[model samples]
Target chain A: MQQEQSIAFKTGMLSICLFILLGLLYLPPESVAQQESSVPPGTAIPDSIQLKPPIHIEVKDTPDDAGGSVTIRWEEQPVLENAVIQKYRILRASVENSVPGEFIFVGEATNRATVFSDGSTDDDSTYVYKVEAVYELKVDDTTVVTTTVQSSVSDEVSSSAQWFNFQRINVFVGVVLLSFFILYYIYQAQSGKKLFIRKIAGLEAVDEAVGRATEMGKKIFYIPGTQDMDNVQTIAGVTILGRVAEIAAQYDTWLEVPVSRSLVLVTAKEIVKEAYSKVGRPDAFREDQVHYLTDDQFGYAAGIDGMVVRERPATIFYMGAFYAESLILAETGNSIGAIQISGTAMPSQLPFFVAACDYTLIGEELFAASAYLSREPKLLGSLKGQDVGKALILISLLVGTILETFHIWQFSSLFKVIGE
Target chain B: MRREIPLLITAITGIVFVLQYFIPHAPFNKMNTWFSDWFSIVGAFAIWLGALNLLKISFQKIMDKKSDWFFALVIIISFFVITIIGFAEGQGFREPGTTFSWLYDYVYSPLSATMFAILAFFVASASYRAFRARNFEATLLLLSAFFVMLGRVPVGDIITGFLPQQYQLSQVASWIMTFPQTAGQRAIMIGIALGLVSTSLRIILGIERSHLGGGD
Candidate 1:
């Protein structure tokens, strides 16, 4: 009887262990099976796509206008003896502190050429580029839908193009005007010449918004945008944040800032602290008021939605780079009837902001906003210089178009030579 | 001196950028290229500065025993791990025939997809919240949003009975995205571009100085 009982007990334990082992092992496979069942065939990443070794790249002067643009060219992979090359993908990455892995898809073209023109007129910057060739494969002999297989990605092609050498006449004209302003401004600045800038209505309401929050004893919600610090718009957002924090400190209003990017979060903390210190309310600065949310876009948006719904801040300020989530956030804040002031350079999100927010800064206006609110002479002077530059561009455009219409090909050629 | 330096740099870079647009010659052409290279270098340095700043603040938060210290700790740990894996692994996931590459392929790639998959729920919830007909404009907005959403999913075809026939719901969706939607987007883009130009001009000319914290 004892021997029989022991055998049964041993068998039960063995079955339990087997169940646990199978449970753990079965989970991942089950999950994967569920995913496969739901996902349509051919939607997932194929087995063939890859990054080849980095390759030597060459940069040459671009044709047309002043040489602000560079044409980068690299050798294509020798076509396999049997396989047909279908397309080339050009990827670009900036050189500084940038993870080389963050290659941006710049251009894609059929196997006709291996050269690409980098005509980004912003300024001189060094960028590393990579190229990959996709090869054609006949998945089935019966149908025309040939599944294209990407070979091991071609080597990353690197090239450096400098825009310092290209100075054109239109640029010269713009330079002359700018030089005149700078010289004029330097003398004026030395003499302490006072300049007047127009008042920014959006900024004017900031103090009132904070005061209202203070009166109601409600927290203030501030979003410094969803972009990393590498973006210029984020820089502007942080600077404006300095002013907001100062008002919050003076009014003793609860100020909460949730940031999507770690870098931007850090900047906001510094700016907010500085503002608090400047307001002589350093003790009131709470570090937790500015916190880093997840870097995931929708995750951050989800967090913001929760915060807005739960806390119900009386005033919300959104400043910086925004994308699709802008509408979701603005609409939520609107539902809460929060007074919203938003500033961003994202053209796509501006309409949503305009529709939802009480005040919206459009495009470059966001960049100029802090200055507009400050009315400082130097800032005002720079804005004037920018205006002069634009006017010069506009005048040049008019003259060039008129000359082209009149068959004065030489004048037309002047502007036609960019990004060749 | 504080304001003068920025003004000079802005004026110089701004003018050169304009000139290069019209004159395509040797020295001037080359100068533009050099300028672009310099800008790239500056941009690179700026990125480094930002990264350093991020490390400094997170480290500070951890040191101070702040209320959200745990979150800060997670951030620092994740940042360092990612950085080390990225640099130490060299080309990281892009490196073929490596463990890191497989990790990226199976782990990071799927994680990204899963995160995007989560968006499906949030989008549905957000649509539910936004679709109420509060006013005429709101009604119009709800209508457009519904069509846009339906036009994207396979269920739209099932409801409309269009895809099996030549009038594929996907093609109709593409047309909606490309034409009327595109027109609206483009109009907004044009306004934004003009606004940007004018605003940049105002800043360069120093007519807008509120950002410097003295306009008050």
Candidate 2:
């Protein structure tokens, strides 16, 4: 009897021990140490328990921008004991497409982020948003609990296109100020005022460059660049071309302009014809003088190269928007002992032109060349006005630097243009 | 009337463009698109004019037996062959595996690449002249170019391995690029921007009319 009783107790104890082991293996982890395994700080636990949602959900249209965006802001709930806030999940629904109270997941942000810019909104549709807060609770020494709570849905809000982007007020003011200066100077010029312009070496060399070609009795090659007529650089180039054409016509020198774009060819021919007429040599301007080449970039370069080699012009003028071909053209001109004058706004190609050409007009100097060559009072006044605008910009830069360094003010922020 | 009409149009168009920059409203928002569409239409017609001009010039050269008339003949033949192929292949001419695509890939692309490849030789020859160190400015340019070139290569690290990390030649090259080079580029950019603004203003106000074949 004693042996049978002992065996019964042993079996019962073994069954109970096996049951406890299975329970431990299958149940959700309760030990805080085990649950905290390798979880770095600030990572949200997906399992949520009940908590107070963020309060005062606010929705507003994004200001000073094109439509199609709404901004969401919320105030966090008052802190409670044992509830550590995690991240907030944002839910949004289009009023046009969904049943009431049903929403699709839009985005999420950390608890610290109070504002969210929702950019995927349609300009015409109204939207409602919900802000849900997630939190963690340590109920006991061995257990960590997660909870989530949602706030009331925001009222329907829609984004509308703004008529004026006020954020760019600073840029508008700058442009207006420049216009005022230019107009005032132009009026001064129209009334009888002598405007002094600092002499530009490139413009000074022009008359000499043309004179050399005339003396040598060689054809003058004028390449108005590879760009079409629409580029501002090309316009500057062709304007300078007018002055060059007049000089060429006066000298009775042969001038050739092999253009890459058809429109540029037409424009150049018109300018040359008018220039010739102005010089009392209308018969001298041939339609074929300004001709078209292939529109391909490198092909245009190759054609110019071939012409330069064959014709061996004494002077070559490269003015406009040139790319890699700038070096090719300049180097070819260099090899033939031709005087090369190049002007372009392209910063990358400026180095090449400076390296290879006899005279180079850098950046703003290209624009100034027209006025410098023509010596028109109105144009000269405009150049002088540009100097004034540049002066103002210099003042702003100095002021901004000093103010920022001293931490007295953020003067640079005034120049920040926010909207396009 | 001829000059006045064009100038008026230019002024109106310029004003509308400035308005569009400040306002995103209906007609202003679509003005640029409408104008660009018109330009493309004109450009398409101009392409034919260009082709005809090329043909006329080439034929004239071939008939007159100008120097290198054979090249003109080749240009004419190649132009027609490619035009015929492009038309015959229809809309799918640009698709892969088509004869037109094959021609573009094998002939046109290689020719373009060859032309671009010639630029490297030109750059080398030009750099030889520019980096001559003839004066103070040239010597500065030469030094900067040498350091920039050295730092871009693996050998730069090996050469400066004994120096402190910040004092390495590669780091020096990076500092030059990040500071002095960028400053110069930005200065030029600012000048260009001011010039562009000033020039555009002149054009809009009709103070600059040389582009329209009128004297200032």
Candidate 3:
């Protein structure tokens, strides 16, 4: 009975000790902070603890661009020159009723950076921004201390869509002026005013090539290039094709067009049919004459080469946009002893055509071919309008060069293309 | 009626597109994108029309036992096989290991590369004919081509090693390309741009109607 009483006394003591330990664990954290502040004298306080935030934080919508972006800029604090700043953190908050909501970390820039472009915002939405300068203080080999002090919150700025970019005003003016000149000349021509157009040898040879094919009793092959109707060069090529088809209908010669684009094929068919009907030979018009070949570049070239070898056409007309296949098609036509006439606005392919074909239209001449061949007053007047435009460009270039030579840059700057 | 309707449509659309360049307002920009989408959709339909036309011609040639009818048969069979493989395999038809991809990699790719390779021979022949020095202009062209060819290779450096680096063949070639060639190219581009603008104006004003098949 005496030993059991001694054991009960020891258990009571142990329960009291356990209660004391749990009480220490649940104590308020402020006491610990108070104790740390009560450090003994002569201890050094780190300089990073006194670091200041960046100054003059500003945010606004970026100018001269398609919207949906805001630019944030700030000035570095003087303390940054002495302190070892690691980086600056940019924080963004959505604005509601003139108040910033919960701040979200947007991005980080290096210590040297003073600008940041925030491209994540929605259009027509207001946003507030802040920049925090971060400083690191290494206490030991294993522990590095970091302190981030944020600047004054930026003013609310909203990204909004812009109508008619002011940056492209130069281009707009140029187009307006050119269109005015062209329209004026066209009106004059319509009113029966005669306009002179220079003769293009390549265009003049079109009739000769068609006649040669007719005399030889051989077919004429017309390729309107490999590109679709979207290309201006291809459209020009089809315009030339219309004239060629008319000649073929009149001469009663076989005309074939193998196109690489579906739209071109349909357009070519309509054009050929119309040409025959215009010549009063609708009976001779065949829908099967103009057809679509493969859209593949080399495949189209191979197909044309095979046709040239097998059918041995007397004349071949290549008028359109071409790339590497230009040389291949031209050389094959030359080999087959055909009178090849090629026209393209592709500067790179011009050399190949000139080298291999009997007649070649150099750049602008290809675009001018239809007007020259048709001799329509409206088309002739347009050519005169183009000459005036050229004269204006030449004068501008000469003036710009002279101004630049004399260190006068304002005139040249007027021609600068913006928002590209 | 046919001519008038088409001309009206052309004028309206052309004016809209031209104005689209200057106006970046919401509805104007939206309309520009919508028109472009319509063109793409119409182009898709045109592809079907073209395919049907091709089939009609090939089938007729096969029936008539025309010369090279075997090629027509080959085209028909290949088109069906490829189309079937593409449809059956879905989007993965173009993936590596599929039949469509295998045909493209082994057959179409090689044929394309072969045709491109033939350009080297053709260039050689064309250059020979062009560089024949038949006349004064031809001789000038030949000289320029020779200088360009020589400057583009290591042999040029070795041949002109006696000159200073600034006056080296490659340096001269660079100068030619940068100055004279660029100037000439810019002039042509300017001319082409003017011509394009004038031609487009004529079309938009309904003054040029040859493309509508010689209509008044």
Candidate 4:
């Protein structure tokens, strides 16, 4: 009887121990949280207790600039009131051939920050980005627990250098249309089609001015402006110089060209030499005639003024781009009783030239000088093409105005030079 | 060969530059920057060439004892002195404490400013000559100038104070600028643009070769 009683006691104890183990295994999650709270507050929380990952992460390439940047944006997922986010950690991975490589820690932003620009990317590369929300819990200002939850990786984005910008497509189209018209007219001109160009008083006076200078036995002064050869105005002035030089060579009149830029001086020397050669008076061509003055705007003006006062040329040509010194030069020329012909594309300086000079080639008339003087078929054709372009622009403006007046705005937007 | 080579180079470069405006690709952009750098280098060389030419001309004039040779001598001396100082001191020549800087600040700046200041007097003279109502166009220009000048000053407002706000001189001036002046300016600009396009096309196609000394 004693042996049987002992066996029963051992069995009962074993069963009780099994019941306790089973109870602990199936304990409610609230009791587990309570048990955890009963411990020291500084204890580390398990991974399951971490904050949720941020939601709706977006990655896109930056636009309208040299390609090298990607923008990453995200918002935090919903969390309990007590959840404290410390910061967000950003990671970047290079994507190659639709496969993502290992991610490297790129940068970090504060907890409240939701945007980051990854500017360290190479041009024409693909990339993926990941954002991690870092949460931190502090106990008694001494111990702290930190955890991180990573957002879903953004879709692959390939950054590429655009070969053509569609935003400026309107400008491109305009250029193409104008070029087509110019080329078509050029072909027609090459086939010996006659075209008419209006008379430019400033250009027509070229012969008169050279003739007067020859008759008066006084030199002719030509100032090809203050800008360098890169300027279109200077190029136009040089073209005019060729014709004037030819006239001077034919008339045996001394022609002086005082230039502000060295390149212009060289170019003027070449043009005059060629002109004299063409006129069979190369012996009259003087290298010293076309000289370089100071590149300073006012210095050139002062030099020209001195020349006007002392040498007292019979005629002066102020052509190409001018700034504040336009009136200064033109007035000084006027004061010397010299007939002045001026041309420039600069609108502000045009009035000054017009006010002081005998004849002023206003705006496009300056560009038209070569075509008018040379009367080359190709040049004449280009001039006619320019008229066509002007007519087109005027028509478009009228149509656009009428359409906009009727509240039909979409038609005008087609001509917008910028935006998507 | 000379003409052909130059024309070919010009055509290629012109087309490339036009394409560069539209292209944002790597090779084209790189080429554009390379060309720009080359242009800057060429510009520096051109400056040197200009300085050398000036020195040669001035020296010749001094030797020949030409008219105003003394001024040429002064220019040469000034040029050499500034160049030497700039070279010796590097960028310090532009600093305030340097002799070069002092010359530029006190001498050059004042001389340039004086020349610029003389423009005011010249403007008055030119305006007097231009506003002489010798013709109908001159009379119209004079009237426009008068209205613009009057409207720019505060006295114009006081003179037109009795008139309606829109009829005031300032308002009238604004209307003239906003409509007539703007219209004229736009017409000029459009014409200039068309001219530029045509001229550029002629140049690229080698039709306008006067700039290269003669026509093709």
RMSD of each: 20.6, 8.2, 6.5, 9.3
Docking level of model 1: incorrect
**Which runs in model 2 stand beyond 4 Å of their true positions?**
A1-54, A75-90, A93-98, A104-114, A118-126, A132-149
**What is the docking quality class of candidate 2?**
medium
- Which residue pairs does candidate 2 place in steric collision? A48-A146, A48-A147, A49-A146, A49-A147
Sorting all predicted structures by DockQ, with the top scorer first, yields: 3, 4, 2, 1
Candidate 4 segments whose C-alpha is farther than 4 A from its true place: A1-66, A69-120, A128-154, B88-91
lDDT (10s digit) by residue, model 1, range B1-216: 755665666657656655555544556556777976775676555555545544666788689987656765765786677667777877545677776677678866786566556545545655565577988977977877767778799887788784465465656677777888887666545444544444444445554333333222
User: Which one is best on DockQ?
Assistant: 3
Distance from true position, residue B112, model 1, in Å?
A: 4.0
Question: Better model by DockQ, 3 or 4?
Answer: 3
Provide the clash count, candidate 4.
0
Model 4 Cα lDDT, one tens digit per residue, A313-396: 999998899999999999999998999999999999988998899999998888989888888888888888888999999999
Q: Write the per-residue lDDT of candidate 2 for residues B79-173, one digit (tens) a residue.
A: 99999999999998999999999989999999889989989999999999999999999999999999999998989878999999997888989
TM-scores of all predicted structures: 0.53, 0.86, 0.86, 0.81
Give one digit per residue, the lDDT tens place, for model 1 in A1-420.
999999999999999999987886656432333343322366443345332322445555464334345566666665443345667666566666456455556667667676767665223456655555555533334322223322223332333334343434444454456656644653574477775545667778888888889998999999988877546677678767877887889889999998876656656877787778888888998767887666677667766877798779999999999987887788788879899999987877776787778888776567666656555555555555555555665686689879888888886566542434
Largest lDDT belongs to which candidate? Answer: 2
Lowest summed lDDT window (length 10), candidate 3 chain A:
A30-39
lDDT of 1: 0.65
Off by over 4 Å in 1: A1-209, A216-221, A227-232, A235-239, A254-315, A324-340, A350-420, B26-67, B84-111, B146-180, B209-216
**Poorest 10 consecutive residues of model 3 chain B by lDDT?**
B20-29
